[model samples]
Target: MSGGQTQEQTPEAGTTETTPKRLPAAGRGGGGPHFNVGMPGEKSMNFLPSAKRLLGRLRPYRAHLMGIVTLAVFSVGFSVIGPKILGMATDLIFSGVVGQQLPPGTTLDQAVAQARAAGNDTFADMLASMDVIPGVGIDFTRLAQVLALALVLFVASSLLSWWQGYLLNDVVQRAILRLRADVEEKLHRLPLPYFDKQPRGELLSRVTNDIDNIAQSLQQTLSQLLSSLLTVVGVLTMMFVISPLLAVIALVAVPLSVVVTKQIAKRSQRQFIAQWQHTGALNGQIEEAFTGHELVKVFGRQREIEATFATKNDELFKASFGAQFISGIIMPSMMFIGNLSYVAIAVVGGLRVASGAMSLGDVQAFIQYSRQFTQPLTQVASMANLLQSGVASAERVFAVLDAQEQSPDPAEPARVTNPHGRVEFEQVSFRYEPDKPLIEDLSLVAEPGHTVAIVGPTGAGKTTLVNLVMRFYELDAGRITLDGVDITTMRRDELRGEIGMVLQDTWLFGGTIRDNIAYGDPGASEEEIVAAAKATFVDRFVRSLPDGYDTVIDEEGSNVSAGEKQLITIARAFLSNPSLLILDEATSSVDTRTEVLLQHAMAALRADRTSFVIAHRLSTIRDADLILVMESGRIVEQGTHSELLAAEGAYHRLYHAQFTQPVAEADGGDAESDVVGASAVTGTLRPRSPVG
Candidate 1:
């Protein structure tokens, strides 16, 4: 990385603070804490932008979305038409029976005589035009027919809505599937620093739970929003047609409801955001605790862990309760306002009816429209939470999707072929963070067929050097080359293919023993796999298993002993047959006998091949062709063991501190192992082929 390049700043991930952080306005909008029910530590999303981006994602499904919306309009339209038609039937029944009553002071017989005189054919019509009794004069056949037609419209409307939901599901789910796949692929492209800052569970939640929320809200709310909006529009149109005065009064409630809902919604947004943030924090805690349950139990810190969990859980609860409670009142509050509007409409319409300015049927229809108008208002209020929550989740998912990717590969990468295992660090400099430089002006070379040992105390930048060789990170200012060609010019894949590594922490995937060994060279033949295993002495124990090489290894190869895991990794390296090999504490986890066997096996593997061995045990690398002593990332000393001992420099002091005391104990008094300088008590040694 160039020194001028800087790390991108983001919200401090995995913060334990219960209070939500205020995001800056430049990247994510800066606002006061917003509520999201049960979600804690989640960033408050820019609703308009996130929704726009979300809509952009649904562009491919425009036709399906339009169809769902159109169907929703029709469904609500048909539902709205039902009551009016029923009211018409009510008028017809009232006229047919109740309106047929004899006029005051006139007997039924006198009305019948007048009707008969007009002729029997016109008599029924005459009777229907007259007043009789309220509701008693209803035409049973007509009433039943009207009710039956209403049922058919309702059923048809229901079926259409169901079909619309099904189509919406297909469209929304497919979009979500693509999004999830993108997130998974993005994980591989993200830089190491991204993972260092973010928790794995947080990323998982973004990929899994957040995207799922968007899909679910799309499925449920999309149709409902469309229908509710149409109903509002339809009810308003009907209300104005019935009585303009009453419609105006009913309209009064809308603004009041909106004002109330807006205030509540604003407060709820912060609560909802806090809820999700706390939820993510809680999940991260659980994941960390579970992964290290053994360590926690060993340390007897159960109570402390429980108390931490309780704190997180309580934060989550308070946030969720706040969000739900605030949002929960929207519907009831709108309903109460609606009732006030209903009373106002009724009183005004009653005066109009008495003054003969409006008919009873018109007043009734107006009342029905008023009720219908308020219902969609309530829905709109409730949808505020769903829409905001869904948008919040979408913003998180998009954040991951839009994260910075790794540096792009060269357009035309150079190929490394038949590499001769020569690696050199030329005036190298690097730092994980800007202010702290880890390595400065580091220069070193390892030639083919030489065992180069790197010895240093912990955090001496030993592993950092190995990381540079493998190009896990970019150099700040340096040129690292393989066989005199700058490695950066070559494709990373081709370069890594020429090197193999075995680390102190063994990594074995969940697979059969054969598969784990063959992971490096997937196309390796069975004979090759077994030969590699035999060379590493892995075959000795593998043959004793009931399934032999075919036995399955549990996750991280926990079913196998640490020694066994190391042996398997060594076998994997053997199968790769790389020109250069790296061994980092390869024998540290094994017993004394196992260590002796592994050391011999490793020595044999290193023969006639360039190797870099990082070791804390000085005795293990006594026969190394060259030893490089490192302190704080700089090479302080370099020479053969005897040459460095004679110089009495850094290497000599380290050797004395580690090996000399042990040798004195093994011998009676003098530190002698082979009639040499402290060598006689240490162990048998080959003649010193000193290099200075």
Candidate 2:
């Protein structure tokens, strides 16, 4: 059975009180300020550690990563050379235009000296810097070759970039697939108590939303970050080759951009953590509201639920807005810094060009390289937001994977063959919390082929008793044995395989009715399923429907009545044909007539099988071989029905309270007559109608 605490109730002295384990307001794995909603706080994960761990998940894909990096390098190399090649073409055109204007057969030095003597010093200085012949015109052939080389380099760069992106995507997908599988396996390895403390929606978010966020973050940031860093390095190198002075001026923006990005990212990281936290919290609230919507409307708490939802939604909005607003500052800040460096480089490069210290083509190419350098820095800063958000999600997922797992199964498991269904609890001690003892040093025995009925009030540890028998929880002390074999010595699966349970709250997945019934024993044949359904009285109602057993159950099973759902669950248990059966208020949802029919069916099912039946309705257990009345997690009374009633102990009182009531005398009647009437009723007492 799924683990849960019973509803809150004040316990008398010497009685056990089962309540949910409370988490500290800021505890790890506990919800934040809104702990009731199951949200983790901002401190749940460290950014650097989580990011390192996330990257470590890709260690197995080293070869693929190396290939991607090599591709990025080649891609950036080709792209960086394009601007320089285009600049060479510009220089060729300029030299050719100047040489065509020069006189043929006149030395360039003579022309430059004449210009200088004619008071054209600036033009003469520029001419002196040129490598043009006196009578040469524009070289169309060389210009075409340079332009063609630039085009080829750019196309090659684009092809390499596309291939790199494809490889990165493939690597990320495969890594995430392994991560998802690990999470799934980890969930199964965790004990039932682990789930008891976690909210359903919060866990679901960790498995679904957080994982997808991690995948998206990796997909968007990995390739872009690699390419952007490479671009920055390649562009910076080209800038230095073109003009060292301008390259140094462009370097001034690097530190400033890093500072701006770092400051904003630090602030935004907390907000992103809070945002995802509230998202899980809000999802938990929404799940609760929807699951209990019928109860909420019945209790007239729609307004209350709506108010709570709005409050949580507002919290999510605040966190989301803060996160986006903070991270959003990175782009414009980096851009502003880059623009400053651009202006400074442009001014310095223009002066060098005018003084003939650098050619006009080199100045233009340097300007282009400076732009390329800053653009990549801006991209890297922008990717910081995604990287931070992804790391936050990765931390959440890692928490689950790191959770304490249930004790391992025995290496050499004890096998039970031809099981006799003899279950014994010897000196068993257990409690959900250390300070609160529910069951201690308890011992009980159920002989093979006997029906044992356990009766108790709310929070009396009745279900806990059955849970221990199933080994859903480990014992704190002592041991339980099945067929003379210590249950802990056997594998949990092999132990549970011998027992079948029919819980009060039935569960049905989205599938055909036949499939849900066959879930008990997947290998069951069609005839076997029909036989089990018929024995449980499920076939009668199912046959009345148009599709009979083929009818599809919706996710919520809304089309099926509560009684029908219970019947389906009962049929499932019956189909398992186990040596032991546990019926936990199995007939609580059926009509009195159906209850009578189910009782007969269960009696047959229980025949020759060791069955543990937990019920509050006394009438259902009257025919059991042994009836145990439990109080405060101890057996207060145990005997046959008649024997317990004759003893007039706790069991007798419970029976009288349920079966006998005071009779009201008519108006003007004597008090003695009322007393006599009430006595007579007690003598001829009858059980109340069973609850449906």
Candidate 3:
């Protein structure tokens, strides 16, 4: 099962169409801001585990984390005290002005005694020591001292906050760096099926977007969370100290604000998930459309593709707007509740102040503390969504990291001492899924130096056969052997070291031509690289370029023609000099001239080496030692081209379909000569062409 394909169904006409069953949607990895629940095709991950794993990532930075916490404590402590100290100044100014207007018998000390009687002994003691400045009638000396200390505390707090942020960035960056490295390493350990079923954009988003979300959230939200928490605690403590009555009034808003924030955030989680999912889906669509732009234009489906893209984009917009709008309400809602509490505190604190139950300075301090308390409440409420998104992203990253890795190399494994390239698959049985049998009890032998050609239509087991040989997918039963040694007993690396493959899809990295040709054996000398290039006839094309072997191939090998890229890959295989070679439609994309040249090159490369050639062009493999025809993942016919043609089997029809046309001539009219004439007409059998 491929994506979007339904299961087999019986029609009203009573015939069943066997559409293969699809893979389960779970464990197919992608990363973005996603909801933990209530979304189509998204896995609901446990928040606690994801959060625990995220914190585990920070274990290595425990010391730095502790230092940051300590700094946060100091930073908040000084900041919290500044408002209280500033309140003292306000009281000092108020008392000095009021004392001068007092009755003739009242002294400043007596006024302080009266303040002590008013249940504010702290304020009374602070006022008794203040120095009165002449003519000013206020304590400028005490005010200057308090203001100076407040300035120092504020500056110190600001410095510590900056240092904490700096340290946090370093710690967070290191942790995310390790996380990215782990995700990349996990990619290598993942099985081929994981890549086969998942889209590239999806996987890339996991590695990039998901991790980035976690990083951004940690960087911004982590420190702010700590600061907000400390501020809330510290402000609440100061509020109660200023006046327990007003503090009780401020506390009334806490539970109410929390209830409102929780309600909105719960709805926003689903929307966030939908938003990111749609974003990822849109990205995948755009990637496909752009990568296959020529196909879109040639097929005149540009408008159709655009419409599909617009639909996905619209969904993303709606989801994003909903999530942000819902989450956006948190700040203002908390602020509204805080303002209501502020009104209540003001009216109540005024009555208490008029009764001389509280000083002007204490009331001012209480008001500031109330504001400070509600500010963190608003911040925490806003951070709720970011933290949710982070946890969601963390779950995605952990999903990949926790997925089943490929089987490890066995301890003290068997090693192929020397490879002579005799390959065999005996009684092999395998299937991608149990219900869909691909290969069953298959047996085959390729003697040393034999060019065995496998010809099949689409969906034949050609690729799977090669994959089995390479141990990409383990066999369900029986064994594959190289030189009569069961390949599975040997480690995958040691087994693959003796074999080389050229796939239909050629891959070239961003490097010079020489570098790509020498990729199989990176240490190959300049002379060896040159020889391999010449052997595969890639030297002709190299010489045509301005920089010869030094010419750079851009990413995806777009700078080179399809035929040229194929030849370069062949040269890469030639450089490896393996004892066994597998070519799966290696020449499918090449021109007739290049295919002819490649055939000769392959002949040279296959000398004294067992080779498996998967070909659609029957003309190129007419002289193969054996030709196997496959249908529905099983070999239906096997023999030399001439022998199979003489038998008038499946291979015969396929051969004639490609090289021979329907004619009045009977079947017995010179089969060998007719083959040669057909080959000449197709220009596919000629090895020495102009590129030579």
Give a tens-digit lDDT track for model 1, residues 339-399.
Answer: 9998998898877755547655677778888888998888888888888788878877877
- TM-score per candidate: 0.82, 0.91, 0.87
- Model 3 lDDT, residue 558, Cα: 77
From the highest lDDT down, the ranking of the candidates is: 2, 3, 1
User: How do the residues 380-490 of candidate 2 rate in per-residue lDDT, one tens digit apiece?
Assistant: 899888888899889989989998898999999998887878889999987766667878788989887788998866566787788898887888899998998999999
**Ranking of predictions according to TM-score:** 2, 3, 1
Reference-based lDDT, each prediction = 0.74, 0.82, 0.77
Give a tens-digit lDDT track for model 3, residues 353-388: 666677777888888888889998899999977877
What RMSD does each model have against the real structure? 9.3, 6.0, 7.8
After superposing candidate 2 on the true structure, give the runs of residues whose Cα lies further than 4 Å from its correct spot.
1-38, 42-44, 100-105, 134-136, 662-692
